[model samples]
Target: MTHILQIDSSPRLERSHSRALASAFLEQWKPYHPGAIITHRDLVRDPVPYLDATWITAKFTAAAAIALSDELVDEFLAADCYVLSAPMYNFGIPAVLKSYIDYIVRPKRTFAVTENGFKGLITHKKMILVQARGSDFRYGSAYASMNFQEPYLKTVFGFIGITDIEVINANRLNTELRDQELAAARTTIQALAATW
Candidate 1:
């Protein structure tokens, strides 16, 4: 059976578009891929603490850091697939999610520095990012360059060796077509359920 890890980062529950998208995806994906085990980690309710000075010290000392980040790193590696809900906060990912990333992106655990540069310890895993944004940041949009959520995620997860990534964006939620766009996203998710 396939294992899936879902991490939701939104501070809001019902009002979060990203969370809604993730929930819909799960509801739709289950029937297509039966017996798929799923795990949940809510960043809002059980936020990953920020890396303090001692945590930084522990990071450099492999043995010490393992105790601090091992659980998260191990959980991350154990998953065959990931579904992440990433809402834009000031043009980038939320602080909670960033903190979570800092904990899991440890050296030697998720990546290694080698003579050839860097090698990712994680491989052959797939990731799907569900994003919520207020502005229109589509490919050719004026503010497209301002969007950092997907790019940064891809880079970080790619560095850790998860190269197969799909992104779903619920864009322009603060606009007049908020409901329309959300409905469109829902439709897209329904279709994706059958395929992805």
Candidate 2:
């Protein structure tokens, strides 16, 4: 069975647009893959701890060189796909979400050094990022220059071998263009849900 890890980063519960979009995506995805197992992680409600000296030392040490904890390695390997709902905060991801990333992207775990430069250990995994922003950042728009969330996520997740990543952005949440942007995002979500 397929395993999907759903992560929500917004502190706002019902008011969060990203969470709404992700819920819609899951509703659509369920029927298509009835056997899929879903695991939910609400970062805002239950925050992940930031990395510290122990985690750093564990990450850098060889897989066989140090006695690594099974809990740490199991968390990274437990999913076949991830659905992340993140709202753009100050032109980037929220601090809580960033902390979760710091905890998961461990060396000799999620990734490792190889003879061909560096290689990510996690493979054949898909990721879907649902982003909500206060300003419109669609291509060719003036506010497009302000978008950093998508690119940053792409870079970081790519580093861990999550190349099959897709983003559905719900932009202009607090602006005059809110309704139009949301409609567009919903349409995109519908299409992606059909094919993804």
Candidate 3:
């Protein structure tokens, strides 16, 4: 059976665009694959703690000490696909999502430094990033060059072998173009859900 891991990092509930898009995607996707198993991780509700001294020491010392990290990595590795929803905060992703990444991206867990440079242990997975931005940051826009979310997310996930990344950016949410942009994003999400 296909296993899907759905992660939502947006702190907002009713007004969260990214979270709604993610739900819309899932709503459309479920019909296509009815038996797919799904796991939900809401970072806002159950926040993953930032890496502390013990967690840092555990990375190089005893494997057993890294219990939480191991659990996070194992959960990540168990999924065949992932739907990650987050809002761009100060040109980057939310702190909760970043903390979750820190927990999972362990040295010998998700990746490793090998003779060939860096090796990503997690393989053969696809990811859909449902991102909500406050301004117009799409390519060619004046503020496009200022976006730090996409590049950082792709790089970090790519480091762990998830190279097939698709992004659905709902930009200009804080402007008059909010309705138009949100509708366009919904349309895109619906189309992608049918195929991806």
Candidate 4:
């Protein structure tokens, strides 16, 4: 059975737009792929610890010598696909999500630094990010220049070898156009759920 890793990073709980979109997608996806395994990781409820001296040292150490936090790493590696639900905070991803990224982007595990450049060890995996932003950040929008969320996520995930990334942006959540934005997002979610 295919395994899907679902990660929810919004701290707003039930009121979070990204969470709603993610849930909608998952609900549609289940019927399409019966017997698929879904693993949910709620960062707000159980946050991953920040990487410090010990973690950093362990990261550089040889696999035989150090006991890495392999549980999260293993979960990430085992997944055939991923659904990340996040709210844009300060024009970037939430701290809890970033912390989870730090944990999964391991050296020699998820990526390797070759003589030429960095190469991503991960392959053939797809990722879907459901982002809820307070303002419009789509290309050609007035505030697109201020959007660090999508770009940062793309860069970091690309560095780790996940290039087949799709983003479903629910923009302008704090604006007067909130309802319209959500409706559009729901439409997009329905389409992706049908195909993805």
Candidate 5:
């Protein structure tokens, strides 16, 4: 059975374009895969704890390994796919989403160092990122210089073996091109939903 992990990071409920797109994607996906199980995590409503001294210590020191906890590990490993809704904040991902990443990307838990260097623990998983931005940042566009969200997400998730990532960007939310960007994002989501 396919188990999907859905995470929404937008603080705004009704006003968030990313959340709306993600909801649509989920609604569309459910009918196609009727037996698929979904696990939802709302980062904005229930914020994840940022990494602190204890988390840092537990990560580096092999002595305090029990502090890492198996529950957290199990939660992540339970999913076969992930759907994330995130909005660009200050040219990057929101703080809440970053905090959630920090919680899940644990050393010796999600990744490990092998004889051939570092290897990602979570493998053969697929991911979809619904990114909402206030400005245009499509490839080769003028505002593309400011696009850090997509690349950053790709890099981080790739490090954890989630290389099969599809990004549907709802850009230019604060610009005159809002409607156009949203339309393009919707098209992309529909295409991805059909194949994913």
Candidate 6:
């Protein structure tokens, strides 16, 4: 059975655009594959600890010697697919999601430093990022250059060997164009759910 890890990173519960899109994606995708195991990680409710001195020490040390947070890494390694709902905060992803990424991307775990520079360890898995932004930052838009969320996420995930990443961006969420953008995002989510 396909195992999907659904991560909701938005602090907003009832009125979060990304959360709603992620829910719609999962609600639609589940029926396409019967008995798919869907694991939910509510980052806001149960925030992953930030990387600190102890965590850094453990990360640089040999895996067998240091006691690291294997549970988070293991969850990431076990998943076949991931559906992440992230909201843009000050032109970037929320801190909770970044913390979760820090936990998963470890040396000799998710990535490796090789003679050829760097290489990703995880392979053949797909990730769908449902992002909500308060402003317009789509490609070629005036504010596009200020967008640090999508590119940062793509790079981070790519560094860990997850290259098949798809982003459904709900931009201009705080503007008068909110409804139109959300409707388009929902349509994209439904379509991707059916195919992905």
Best by TM-score: 3
lDDT of 3 by residue, 16-113 (tens): 99999999999899989989999998899899888888778878785567787888888889999999999999999999999999888878778899
- Candidate 4 lDDT (Cα, 0 to 1): 0.89
TM-score of 4: 0.95
lDDT of 4 by residue, 1-196 (tens): 8899999999999988999999999998899999999999999998988888767877787544234357788988999899999999998999999999988888888999999999998899999989999888888999899999999998988898999998899988899999999999888888998899
Better model by TM-score: candidate 2 vs candidate 6: 6
For all predicted structures, in order, the TM-scores are 0.96, 0.90, 0.97, 0.95, 0.93, 0.95
- Scored against the true structure, residue 166 in model 1 reaches a CA lDDT of 83
For model 2, what is the C-alpha lDDT against the true structure? 0.84
- Sliding window of 10 residues with minimal summed lDDT for model 1: 60-69
lDDT of 5 by residue, 1-196 (tens): 8999888999998899999999889888888898999988888887866777776777677556444345545777899999999999887899988877876776777888889987888899999999998877889999787888888999888887889998888878999989998888888878888889
TM-score of 3: 0.97
RMSD to the hidden true structure, all candidates = 1.1, 2.6, 1.0, 1.5, 1.8, 1.4
Residue-level lDDT for 115 in candidate 4: 100
Reference-based TM-score, model 2: 0.90
Worst 10 residues of 3 by lDDT: 60-69
Give the higher-TM-score candidate: 2 or 4: 4
Q: Pick the candidate with the highest lDDT.
A: 3
* lDDT (10s digit) by residue, model 2, range 86-127: 999988999988988876677777888788877888899999
Error of 5 at 89 (Å): 1.0
lDDT of each: 0.90, 0.84, 0.91, 0.89, 0.84, 0.89
Query: Candidate 1, which segments miss by more than 4 Å at Cα?
Result: none
lDDT of 3 at 77: 91
Q: After superposition, how far is residue 26 of candidate 1 from its true place, in Å?
A: 0.9
Encode model 6's per-residue lDDT on 1-196: one tens digit a residue.
9999999999998789999999988898889999999999899999977778766776787534234367888988889999989999988999999988888888888999999988999999999999999989999999898899999999999999999998898999999999999899889988898899
